[model samples]
Target: MTRPAAPPFAASATDPIRSILMNTLIAPETDQRRPEFPTQQPRIEVVAPLAPGDEAILTPAALDFLAALHDRFAHTRHELLARRLQTRVDAANGRDPKFLPETEWIRLDPEWRVAGAAPGLEDRRVEITGPTDRKMAINALNSGARVWLADQEDATSPTWGNVIGGQRSLYDFLRGQLEYTSPEGKEYRVTAERTPTIVFRPRGWHLVEKHLRFHDRAGRSMSASGSLVDFGLYFFHNAEALIAQGSGPYFYLPKLESHLEARLWNDVFVFAQQELGLPQGTVRATVLIETIQAAFEMEEILFELREHCAGLNAGRWDYIFSIIKTFRSRGRRWVLPDRTQITMTVPFMRAYTELLVSTAHRRGAYAIGGMSAFIPDRRNPEVTERALEKVALDKRREAGDGFDGSWVAHPDLIATAKAEFDAVLGERPNQLDRLREDVEVGAADLLDIPSAGGEVSDAGVVDNIAIAIRYIESWLRGVGAAAIDHLMEDAATAEISRSQIWQWLDNNTVTAEGTRIDQTSIVASMAAAVAALPRFEGDRFDDAISVFREVALAPEFPTFLTVGAYARFF
Candidate 1:
């Protein structure tokens, strides 16, 4: 197939290869030039258009390093992913997750501790997360929060442009050359002293970067693992620079299910460090204990990566989605209430968070709280005040309960969340010292879904359908995080919304209004929601509806809506 012409902006750039790469649209193509490598020469074909300035990040050295990573770890990743499937099936079949008897000794051993926090990460009281686009990257780095999660996972749509463009943004940010100019003549740049620490979040193990392919033994092209592609590119390009700037290559691992998965990541870290001639433990990672299975193995996860571990994070939305997913086939007892009703204070959620804090502290690691999804509405003081108040309450709970820090989706909420943490921290950096030995939880506590009491409502169902469609539409447009109804909705939130609809319909869940949720009600609600939405040019409302319905009403629930929806775009 003939490649599309590069965008005008992309062509005007100084770099020749960048112009060529950016001019070529992403599609499956055969590799014409075979390059030599130190050990192996895996065939790599890049189909994505290299956006303007992307050449600086996608250098030959970087691509070679990425290929080396794939050569070494791709096979292990495939095995671990297969293990995840078998484990999920076992969980759904009534084999509840608990602390592995084999790994109990690691938890009991009190002398072991995770490597101390790297520089720029010692005081992460308030961290803001967003996609790694130019404007958002500049804004987030300038935000007063202590850390900025440069997310390439849930907060990113994984479009060809996004995958390459995001790397360019991060590359520029690390080099202190990232800047953006608004149409209104406002210029944004990272302030040296005030810039938040950068911590990258790569895509999860389950995802595959279809635009980049590696040849297998049979000479058939296979999609490269998303995790390796993202992490490899960033680390290969910027690890040395970050280390020189008084910080190491920091990362946040997402959607990990077991300590064994964590072990795979640790092995990758070790290999990457050795490959680049960096010292051992130069990379620091914080694991998001999002999956229900992971919650049961926090200590073991930390233990596996102790030399490279920084902390643990309370991943809220995905955690709820995991609960629904693992127990989808198991009847009503496993069914959760409305997504809105499943707050952190619920018995099961509280148990999860408490356990997380205790586990992190016990292992001498930071325990970061969940994201406060409330985006500030500046037009209405009442709305802003209410949102801030709720945020304050949530932060206060986290701080009081021995959390080291927390996350906020918006820069506006930083002060509010910081103040709450400040009140409890009071000049101290973190609460890792306050080990909550008092908290004891069992499998029942973690699985106590029936205790989160609230009935499904028609409004709740409509909200889910509307948000899922809206978010997916934005995702199709290459925007991962969307501010809708005064809340920031990302892939995680969309997953929870759609998965809840699936679970509800499958269980014949009745709303408080004495109505049973079925395909007919869902169809009506979907139509009504789409109609109520204001029309926009080139909006993918229809596509979003189709994707949502397929995932929510399919005979077998898809692992992730993005897995199926991604094909529509590429």
Candidate 2:
């Protein structure tokens, strides 16, 4: 009368009639298809880089796609209006290093598909720090990023595969160079070697072009082509070319905060694709809105990149810093903590995630959660559970918030990360008809905000320093911790102020708990920074404003940093 769980214990094919009778009563009522992002006619156009014309020798998928493309669109030219409509702007117009990579060797020109942008934001890719090197990069790749960043920026170490090391890694991946050792201690090899899954994040384009003058043994140019561009310039020159190369990074746009920023990126994509002979809209981009202004303009920024952008990400660590910075300047009650731990609390995290989810899902875009820099202990006895715990917590938060996926640092964690994310994205199906409508016709209002001149100007820098100094000094003197505020010792709002107290414990600039200030490095960095800035006269003018003008956030900077010129000023 009933179906039992264990079939192998008793049943066989002869029970089909019984199985059918049981199925009629107990079949599950579940959606057959997992809910998928609505698909569209492919928007990217791969121009021929070889001899023929607009078609290059196709990969299997490309060949099938090309055949289908010709069959479907051979009668149409309006299909290409998207590429032709790229912004007609000059590349030389950019003035900010923040906007450009050091060189334009590999520019990321993203197109904002109609699916991924919010109502107001256009998709604009900005550069964040490149991620760590190859093996970990493979980890990120399997982690399912729409964009894979091989970090050369802040996330990498100098000795352990930094710029030069990164370049070697890239060329090796590109060339498919690899070897191995046998289990019996015999040196053998892998018969198959493929490029590391993520794209290469070489040294900063500018850093490579300017500083790294590596030569081969014969004193020849390390590169036969001496025409290496900086990050920004290479983006200008080779973005489209990189796309054409097929094996270069598909692209992951980084660190953007506004629609105008997206516009500039779009314009760069347009010019590079057109002038440099790469396919239009092929180089995808993802944006990192890590600053205050970026949060407000999500809709506009996303939509603007509809033609060239990938997806938007909530850059948590940087975004958190930006949020506190904004509050310090704009809120009547301004304060920030010194420790990173206290700063990232539930409330703050919720606010960030809510805004991010609402914005990303509104347009059907992939909501990629931020990174967890938990470098694993390979030798640890309990590594598996430790990793499992880490992934479970992260994915629980991400899945509950409806994220498409999350990122991890090492390949070791890939299985756990994938399992957790895949579990969350269970098969909830939806139809494309309801999702894809022409909604952005008059929605230009979202993109119409006048771009705020960012925090790079002299006055802006001065203001930033002023707030930083006040916060730091308060921590040093122990005034901030006890002052009128809503804070725990661990809160970001206080960590920036109470860190020296923590520093006093272990000669570290900051720790979770403490009662006194470590004035050693604090005094040094503040002194250096104070020397770097303008000094206002005062009889014992050691408070924030004077300290700010002297050291851009004088008291705290030195507590954590060693001696350096930027320690004081630019």
Candidate 3:
């Protein structure tokens, strides 16, 4: 069946009121160009050259579906993002967030539950997450985990090549034709008998894909929302095929701040399913409760998408960044120490996770745990052993706390994580029955950041500077997940690092070594980090340094570093 065409934007010179409304809702401008196509049909203009194999995924039908999504939801997305900024401003002015009093009835209602798990998602004891490159896709599918989170957001750099090429790779894998040969002649392919269930993660609501402009307004082009573009292209090309194979289109929704955003996604799902002639709830999604605001509204979020909800995930790094971002202006009480010091065992984090487990279990949804960022260092046995011990302990904690499953970055860590879950869930697929009635979390408990006690140290500051610069450099070079100092560093980690630096400097945090962290000290650290790095061929590092300073030291904190960096680099 053919999908319906999207309505055109009000581009006529006579429609002054419609043009004013559109301009007010959308951003000021973007670097998008008009497509060479007839005016009646939807147009998808590509800003970059399509890679050799990109045609397999970016077919005409796929582009039309994407344009339809843009037309339907792009305006809503714009308004939601503007709401986010206004909320932040209110938060900074001491309008602290709490459970929505209006939505309390939804949470109090006892007769509701999220839909049952989709086929192949009944047991998610171990899920490996990474970018969608061909080699990584093959490795993750063969990693013996129950699910592979093919990430296109935090773990991907979103270069035009990476975006189109990654979609091509997923298409090839779904068709059982994906294979890769290394420079040393080693071949890799998916294991037919034990491939993990695929769950795709699109970009967050804050980002935009400048390469694909689908609408024109006032003689300027409008870029498609990145989240819609990713979701539309993937679902258009693969949804029916996945359902035929007994699995359906699954997603991990990232960086959502409110139940309203969840409602938006549910509406999109409804529209997409109806347009494609699929049954309701054909797409199941796991909401990542990674924001401080989202933690308070878990039940509401689930209710908004209950028909299409699979579960909720505890996203650790981004959660930290969100706390800092939401309360950065609240002074020392909200100032966090080193990122390394804030473990899951801390009071605030414990409150967050325990509430998550109880809420998900109560609603008959799976409660997934955070990622173990340790990448095994096989070269040094002691390093590998120590890291494995830490990972095992973390997993054991999550499983014992009633998490149905957990995330790991490397294949080597999967066995270790699964073993812990196996111990807790012997002969059982999950622990969704363990509804912890003892979990009594309040706003004060979730906001008790000061209980995490650790003084910032010189070493921590230097490490933050080093990791931010290093990760941003790799990000600029089109690599999202980089192994640095035996940990898998991605955009979330970078966000935490740079944000901590800004927080410390703004609050005049005194380090353990009797030195005060300030703009001068941070600048010195940045220069030192740059000089200590091994020689690189390109100016990407220089660009990363500039971007890092702009975000970290700005008078006003930018909501996301990736948004600015994407425009600057891509």
Which tens-of-lDDT digit does each residue in 28-47 have in candidate 3? 33433322445664466666
lDDT of 3 at 168: 80
Clashing pairs in 3: none
Ranking by TM-score: 3, 1, 2
lDDT of 1 by residue, 510-548 (tens): 899987888887778777888877569999888888999
Pairs of residues clashing in candidate 1: 6-23, 26-47
Candidate with the larger lDDT of 2 and 3: 3
- Superior candidate under lDDT, 1 versus 2: 1
List, in order, the clash count of every candidate structure: 2, 76, 0
Best by TM-score: 3
Root-mean-square deviation of candidate 3: 5.3
Superposed model 2: Cα runs more than 4 Å off: 1-147, 157-161, 178-249, 327-332, 337-345, 382-384, 427-570
Off by over 4 Å in 1: 1-42, 183-185
Candidate 3: where is the Cα deviation over 4 Å? 1-42, 216-220
For candidate 3, the per-residue lDDT at 368 reads 97
The TM-score values for the models, in the order shown, are 0.92, 0.49, 0.93
How far in Å is the alpha carbon of 547 misplaced in model 1? 0.7
